[model samples]
Target: MIKYYYPDGSHCYRALHTAHAVFRNEAGALIARAEKPDGSALYEFEITGFELVVAGERCT
Candidate 1:
């Protein structure tokens, strides 16, 4: 899963590597706004059909 942090120090999570849909809500509109729970927005991106994967161990 993907762990997203907010500007206010809060965070959320999402499943990665799956053909699932992701979203973000801002000012009454849903867009690619993965903002930190602290109200901080993340890197600007227009993505779809991909899950978020957090940093973890790597296997070979």
Candidate 2:
């Protein structure tokens, strides 16, 4: 699930994003996501760092 992902407070200086995460199952793999707050998949979404996502919510 997407929510179970843990967010790191950095998006790298080259790229600007509020959240960056990696699934618990993966190691040393960084990820970027733009899903809606309601757990719906977004064709195009924006990140403002104010999302109330949990640690186990799925996105689709």
Candidate 3:
């Protein structure tokens, strides 16, 4: 699993097999838009603030 962190210390997580992801928070939201490495939008989400633990495969 891959971990993603915010400068503030929050985190988000995802499975290596996850094809898409969406994260949200109180202040706002973030879209971990997916693609085929060629840059595409598989899916997206609105998240807020920051994340704590993000796990997933790194896009090529």
Kindly give the number of clashing pairs for every candidate.
8, 4, 16
lDDT score at residue 53, model 3, on the 0-100 scale: 33
Better of 2 and 3 by lDDT: 3
lDDT for model 1 comes to 0.42
lDDT of 2 by residue, 1-60 (tens): 223223444321212132344222244343344444554553332222332344333342
Among these predictions, the greatest TM-score belongs to 1
Task: Please give the ranking of all candidate structures by TM-score, highest first, separated by commas.
Answer: 1, 3, 2
Query: lDDT per model, in order?
Result: 0.42, 0.33, 0.45
TM-score of 3: 0.28
lDDT: worst 10-residue window of model 3:
51-60
Task: Indicate which candidate wins on lDDT.
Answer: 3
What's the TM-score of every candidate structure? 0.31, 0.19, 0.28
List CA RMSD, all candidates: 11.0, 11.2, 9.4
Model 1, span 11-60: residue lDDT tens:
55554432133465464332344444444445443432232454453211
